[model samples]
Target chain A: MTAWLLPFLVPFIVMNAILGIVTYVTLLERKFAARMQSRIGPYRVGPHGLLQPIADAIKLMMKEDVVPTAADRPIYNLAPIVFVLPCMFIFATIPFAPGLGVADLNIGILFFLAVSAMEIVGLFMAGWGSNNKYAMLSAMRAVNQVISYDLPFIFSALTPVLLAGSLKLSDIAAAQAGLWFIFYPVIGQLAFIAFIVSTVASENRAPFDILEAESELVAGFRVEYSGMKFALIQLGEYAHVIGASFLGALLFLGAWAGPGPEWLGPVWFLITAMLIFLLVTWVRWSFVRIRVDQILALSWKALLPSTLLLLIATAIVVVWRGVPGV
Target chain B: MTIAAPRHVELDYTGSERLTMNMGPQHPSAHGVFRAILQLEGETVVGVDAVIGYLHRCHEKLAETLTYAQYPSIASKTDYVAAMTSEFAYVRAAEMIGKIEVPKRAQYLRVIAAELQRVASHLLWLGTWCLDMGGALGGGATIFLYCIREREMILDLFESLVGARLLYGFYQVGGVRYDLPAGWVDTCRQTVDVIDTRIDEYQRMLEDNPFFQVRTQGVGVISRELAQEVGIAGPLLRGSGVAFDIRRGEPYSSYEDFEFRVPVETSGDCFGRYKVRMAEFRESLTIVRQALDRLPDGPISSRPGLKSVAQTRIPKGEAYARVEGARGEVGCYLIADGSAKPYRMKWRGASFSNLAILPHIIPGHKVADVVAIMGSVDPVFGEVDR
Candidate 1:
């Protein structure tokens, strides 16, 4: 009975912790983006806007859930839940520190990548069920964009898997104990760059964020959603972004391997993850969004072929050097 | 029934369904209260039906009711983004028909106000144009905030000069109502100098940026012939290789006293328009500095201060006055019947003419390019609707 309850308790705790972190991550992004834009952002709530997210959460919960009359009832109602589940589920496989995560599966990278891509299903459901043209158009663009970028994202993630000779994310993190993958001469740098570019595109950030372009599509697939549903969709997006940052930290930046005491490993991992998140956020705030055609052309003509080539080169190097752990 | 008689059927699979999307009057990037009903084939715009008059306040009819003394203030509402120039056009038309001799000092002061208004208006155009293209949450907001920072300084200068920030009724029938206050020139000089450096910073941020280039370059091509045929004015006209500027072609308000260059671009694309406005920023600044250095000391008004609504009356005649407003050539056509109020007043709003080119050039472009082209056109609906 204790063993069964423990299994459930850990996941419940992890989910709550992630929810808290995701809310704060939004505050962090707002403050950071505000700094870049030369203004103070969200300083009226708690001291320095620390409790702004909590206030926002309460406000969203209290607001009435508005449903469009023409909406496909079941799909519109369930889309946010479905969209948010996969985003949070990706975090289950990410090893925040060695033996510190909810579940460190053997097929960690693959699980993370596949689960992250599943958000598109919920995204499309929301777009199609909203019965709005902007939502429908944005949903179509999301399907095209997410499917195209996923390949390059997978190819780049596979580079670390190839270097470590392990499918486990813990093994990948451990292999970078000697030197972080980002500092590995040429191949690692090239693969890391590809990973970041694909991450930005897959995350629907600018200059690749043409789907929910505020100037054109308004809020895009989530335009019709209000109250808790809008909050859920926003949570899923930030959770996905945070999940990618964690994966990037583990894959390239030697997560949990910084200089400190053994117990401080998780702190180092959090700091590293935050740094990666900031890097992506910086890119998002620095460029205008490209057109949908241009975004697709970039993914196919530039990111796909180059990441494939880099993956092949990594495979060749791994075979020659007999893989690090083996 | 179809299976019983399977005749050879011709199916047109090449033609896709056209989506009719309404953008504006409530859009985030509509710039103002203007709407475009776009017929879209996939993402490409096949046709656009623009709708205006959401902001119309019957300024022409108001001109018929209000005297010349009161109309200049209302004229500022037409092109509220450049209130000084809008008021300039109306008062210049009154003075033209009335044959009122404006003092040299007043004319120079008008030049200073008009040039400063140009800088402020162009700064606003740059900010909103980037905000429309780049988005409110992205790098476009960065540029937008920075541009607004500089524009605020210019507004502060206007606030000091006219005691109003946005819509200033500084011009009267005969001359400007206010003279330069003590040490205002020093403050004006300092503000323009700071804005000059700030413009360089904006150029560094956006000019040569690949994202900006991809969005603007060759996106909205207004051919030289098309621009002339459509009767577009100001930067839209200059951008398309037309060297017709009201300031140079027909100088008014002692514009001939100051020397300046009008920038022209032959490309006639969005980027060309962007370049024309940026160059105009520097040229306007130069004019402000020159006018400040040579500001003569004399009375600000040729006529006595207004004591009644019908103090300034025009003889029965008609005259057209055009000023190089920040948007384009803001012209006022007035016909007075020996009364304090005009019998008929027609406003030749530059944005109104500039927007006419939209339907001519908008077809065959994507939905995204629509905003880019509209941003480049920079239509102030206050003028367009009026």
Candidate 2:
């Protein structure tokens, strides 16, 4: 590691930062809820509950790692890892700033799509392997909701790629150097709206959170998990949300392209990511959850068609103009 | 009672893949220790069996062992959320059997206490119901917190009067145990005003919310004929356009002196019931204001000559007293055989009847609608299983 933050150490630094941010995201949610509900949030452990996440991690460690006797032990042991890896892995190809990331893979978006899809498998395993009826029901819902939302999510995300004429995240950001994609006329704005909706749905945030509705299935897929295993699942969930927010930032908001000095490029990226995360938190707290049928109906009926039309229009615009980025 | 199973929706898909999920004996949104076996065809609820009685306290039987004058404390436990109504019913039954004349001031005070109790119970119902709807007013827990904050102001007022916050056995057979204290009426008006403002805030938050409308409107609709056949009362009945309220029709206590309109809706759905309860909050406040304004200056208790509760003699026969409780009708039946203790007692808890209609309503809707419908029904387990 050098003074400039070495290339080899970038993965280590980013991974640690992502994990740290994941911990604080939970704190952010708690504080956000407290402020909305008119109560003082965590304030005992640290100054304004800054160290609450560390305390929570330690408390989870001290707790007994309970495995249900009837559970599929091997899969139960592996589920958290399977779920968490893809979430962290997606950060690898996410260019935080110009040349200030782990990898500049040409197929960064495709890699993100493939890796994120692996999360549902891990989620299903967490549900199925638990050998509980509620868990199974939740897993079935997760499969249905995730798969249905994925189409709209991809179609919406691909609009920027169509405009950029490249799969690389850095190139996409570079394409938006002149102007952020959100300001790219009516077409970009439409895709941005669709992209945000699909993002919430795909990430299984309420009101699309039929999988872990808590009131219905009692923590849903992770109904049987405990101790560090339970902690891992929660970590994976927040990380996945943050990862999705990062992707949203890059695709629509022009990641790291803020009014700042060159040295503060990655800092701008972090700020943008956090702002997007705050937006997600706002939505998660604001709306009631929709029924599973209604969620599917929304994706199929409204989001899918609108995003598809936007995608086609973006493609035509790219071909007609022969855009500079293309 | 074996109610007929509800008709399932005619889905085009074959029912090859089915799932059964047990909701709770300890679930948060169940209200209290309620279990429901939900039969599902992939999130579509095909059938439901509501299992209850986990909070059973043998309340009616326990009343037989206690002295006639001492039963009000026990009655408070039956519907702990709105303890004043249960206490009032028990004392009113005793007063009816003994031919006791309540003081003019005591009757007005009873009206005030009972109306306030209705407001408190309805506030609690609104909060928990929003919690069950999973983020209607705000998040699942946000509206609950806001409502609880408002409820705290009411509880504080009650605590100052009765020296107990939740289960206040503040009524005697003849009159109330305590009178309104100095500056209490003004404080009550102020609290009611704050509550009125908050009720408007909740309406602004939930009534016009598109998400709330989508989840609640036309969902869990109980037809007028079905609601009448099942004999629902209170807001559930009013929501179905039955237009029957015990307070309005029967005019118990000093209700005849206060004029307020009964809120009725024709939708007979969760949203309709929500609107009815919201209207009830305002009406309850109106009744409280009227009772306070017309409050007479007299002795708090008619039987102030009596030294202690145990010394009070009862020359009684069978008597029944029913009140318009928050849920519906809360009736207390006393069968006194010319003695200090009752031979038998029967409590007709409204929650039992309200909860009975669950199996009839849940089959055609999705599983999530169970939470909405159950919340709209507003069953208290303490009342249901007493």
Which has the greatest lDDT? 1
Q: Please give the lDDT score at residue A107 for candidate 2.
A: 93
Highest-DockQ candidate: 1
Q: TM-score for all predictions? A: 0.97, 0.96
Candidate 2 lDDT tens digits, A1-326? 37676766888999998999899988988898788878889999999999999999999989998899999999988998898888788888999889878998999998888888779989999999999988888899999999999999999999999999999999998898888898899988998889888988998887778888877777889989989989988888888899888888898788888776887877777778778888877777767778888898899999999899899999999889887564
Candidate 2's error at B78, in angstroms? Answer: 0.8
RMSD from true fold, candidate 1 = 5.2
Question: DockQ of candidate 1?
Answer: 0.76
Provide per-model DockQ scores: 0.76, 0.49
lDDT of 2: 0.86
Q: Ten-residue segment with the worst summed lDDT in candidate 2 chain B? A: B1-10
For candidate 2, what is the TM-score? 0.96
Local error of candidate 2 at residue B297 (angstroms): 1.7
TM-score for model 1? 0.97
Residue pairs whose backbone atoms clash in candidate 1:
none
